[model samples]
Target: MSAKTIVVGNFKGGVGKTKVAVMASWELAHEMNKKVLLIDMDPQANATTLIARSAGITEIESSIFESFENSDLSKSVLNVKENLDLIPAAVSFKNLPKFLYGKFSDDIDQVSYLKTLLEPLKKNYDYIFIDVPPTISDYSDNAMMAADYVLIILQAQELSLEGAETYISYLQFMIDEYNAYIQVAGVLPVLLRPGGRVDHATVERAKELFGEDNVFENYIKHLERLKAWDITGITYKDHHDNRAHQIFIEVVQEMLDKIEHFEGGEVNGE
Candidate 1:
């Protein structure tokens, strides 16, 4: 089965991009029993740290950079759980741009290198989720080039909204310039506060800008448990943890629905 590769990102930092990517991958693998692979494209390695904690790994032996350098990502795969796997990132991944330029003469080859490398492994999983840094760089370019869909994270602020818009614009640029076959999955809102004035106004503005249907109905409310997961490594120890997990489960279900709709030839933002 060919996996549906999705890149979760935003052009603004602190918009919960890595959190959404990690939790969504966790829910899909741990909760729904799906074979999932999470590829951390961010050099910060936040996703790597959390998943490593979950797997009880104190030190990273390998990273995606090694896979890229070796031209075989399978060699770097680390099993996080029963159905979950991860290709961790390293700070050394910042050298990717230089490596790409040194390896390929054409810009297309540079941008699409990750896609070429990932194609062979697509048949091994149900889904492949990529978490990239919040910027327009080699990391994001490679991730976008390799993905079938991009899930934009909107954190319910004016700057975040602008970042989402800029991200969509860049996605379109990728499609038009390099012929990357990808689509915007949908905008998932991460609220600063549930029912707060800024949160309400931001979401309304997002719906108007991105179209009502293009914005997810189920949003992520600010939760202490989510913050705790950064340190505790995604535990489900209490009622609050279950509640937070349930919220992502709903979001993921909706994401699947949107993907199905897109596959059926439904136009986005319609």
Candidate 2:
């Protein structure tokens, strides 16, 4: 089977996109024993920092933008662990938009540049996850056009729900204008406060907007360990918190199920 590329993205910031991208890729690699390649498409590189910290990597030598400009993807790849690999990001990636502008004219397939770069390595892994920035830019568009599926991360809040819709709309725009072949895996709700009325309403609104099946059943609840990971650069395993660990496990299982189901249906001509 070819690698299934899932881009974790949102149109707004601070809604746990990197958290879901990092933890989901970690669980898939460590627990499920799958070969996973995580590309840090965002210039902020939070996902890169989290994965790099876990592996004791202090500095990244090459950023993913090198693949776009130089046509050598191997320069950016780093073996982070047994089953996990990374193409880390750097602050210099912020200059990619300007560089891309010079490479692609109005008639060129600008958005498909990443897809072309990643095509040669499609069969190297079981999964490839890309972490995109919050806004829709040249980088995020490259990620979107490169993905087989898009996993949108949302929080249990009104503004986040709206952000989820905005991202879905952007996906539609890409499909319509650029002829990108991609689908939404699902909308994952994070930071769930179970007992709060606002949280309940937000969940219901998500179901109503995206359909019950389109939104994942397992929601990632807020936990102190997750918050601490950002500061101390610790992992879910380092904390020994079953609550947070199990939540990530369930999410990985759900993600696996969706991908298998989607891919199988595609193969059988469903």
Candidate 3:
């Protein structure tokens, strides 16, 4: 079966986009026993760092940049867990735009190159999650063109909400301009606090803007364990770690349910 590619993104930074991408992939692979591939398209490579730390790898010999240069992403695939693989990103990936411009004269070809490269590898995994930078750039364009769906992260803030709106508008632009076949899977809220006033109001505004049905019910709560994982890598040595991981499990279940609904031919708002 071909993998369903999903890009986790936001137009604003510091919104936990990587957290959702990494944790969701981890949950899908470790908890649900699905074969998952996470492509770190962001040049910052935070996803690559975290996953590498989790896998106990201190050095990366090759990265997605090498794969892009070779036009073979499968060669860069690194096993991160039992069912999870990764195409690590490097600082060198910042040259992707120059690389694309050198290769293709057509704008569409430049943007959709990742789609062509990913087609051969799609059949090997159940799901492929991409983590992109928080901006409108070649990285995000390639990811959106390659993806089947986008999971927009809505952090509880005015700017974050605006970023999500901008993200949807850009997605529509991609659809209209390049005819990219991708859908908005859902808007997932990552709250600053469990029941903070700003958090609650931001979510309400998101529901009003994106429609209630398109917003996910399983919002991510503020968890300190998540921060710890960034430094120490993902852990399940104690109840706190499991509790933190459980949050993503619930989120993934809802995400999969939404995906199934979309696959069943039900429109998101209807």
Give candidate 3 regions above 4 Å deviation.
Answer: 157-160, 193-198, 265-270
For 169-264, candidate 3 gives per-residue lDDT tens digits of 999899999999998889998865545434678788888888888899888888888988999999989999989999999999999899988788
For 1-270, candidate 1 gives per-residue lDDT tens digits of 788999997898888899899999999998887889999999999999988886788877899999999999998898888989999999999999999999999999999999999999988888899999988998999999999999988877454478888898898899999999988899998865545434677788888888888899888888878888888888878899999999999999899899988788532223
lDDT per residue for candidate 2 within 178-260, as digits (tens), equals 88888889888887343423377777888888777778888777777777777766554544566777789999888777766
TM-score of each: 0.94, 0.91, 0.94
Number of the top-ranking candidate, with TM-score as the measure: 3
After superposing candidate 2, which stretches have Cα over 4 Å from the reference? Answer: 192-198, 236-240, 265-270
Best model number under lDDT: 3
The lDDT of each candidate is 0.88, 0.81, 0.90
2 or 3, which is superior by lDDT? Answer: 3
lDDT of 3 at 90: 94
- The ten-residue window of minimal lDDT in model 2 covers 261-270
For candidate 3, the lDDT comes to: 0.90
Q: What's the TM for model 2?
A: 0.91
Against the true structure, what is every candidate's RMSD?
Answer: 3.3, 2.8, 3.1
Candidate with the larger lDDT of 1 and 2: 1
